[model samples]
Target: MKKTYKIKVDCAACANKMEEACKKTEGVKDCNINFMMLKMKIEFEDGVDKDEVMKEVLKNCKKVENDCEIYI
Candidate 1:
């Protein structure tokens, strides 16, 4: 399944970095961060746990932008 999440990203670099962070997450299959919308679309691989994946998303996103929100 795919979900769109609201991300509090500052600029293009941060957005790109956030996308990379999400993609590197273990449970995630794909990720796209749109700077204009400040939203991140995530697709999970089959059998991946959504809650577990989101935890990874939140953790990695913090590395890109501290205190940023990622609404799933």
Candidate 2:
């Protein structure tokens, strides 16, 4: 499944980092962050709980970009 959420990121580079972080997270098959739109699109793995997975995605994104925010 795929979903899009509002995101807060300071710059394009940080958005790239967030995208990479999200892609590396478990339960995520793919990810994209658009700095211009301040949004994140996530493609989740089959049968995974999106809410729980997004929690981890947000946590992982924070590791690389501490000030970034993803609205659950």
Candidate 3:
């Protein structure tokens, strides 16, 4: 399944970093971030718990961009 989420990121480059971090997270099939829109789109692998995955995504994003926020 795919979902869109509101996000807080300082810049386009930071958004890109968050996107890459999220994509590498387990249970995430893909990820995209729109810096202009302050949004993130994520595609999850089938049957995964989205909440759990999102928690991990947020943690991973934080690693690359300390101030980034993804409103799940």
The C-alpha TM-scores of every prediction are: 0.91, 0.97, 0.97
What TM-score does prediction 2 earn? 0.97
For 1-72, candidate 3 gives per-residue lDDT tens digits of 999999999988888888999999999999999999998999999999999999999999999988888887
Tens-place lDDT per residue, model 2, 21-65, is: 999999999999889999999999999999999999989999988
**How many clashing residue pairs appear in each of the predictions shown?**
0, 0, 0
Candidate 1 per-residue lDDT over residues 1-72, each given as its tens digit: 998888787789988988999899998999998899888899999998898889988999898889778876
In model 1, where do residues sit more than 4 Å from their true spots?
none
- Tell me how candidate 3 scores on lDDT: 0.93
lDDT head-to-head 1 vs 3, winner: 3
Summing lDDT over every window of 10 consecutive residues in candidate 1, give the lowest-scoring window: 63-72
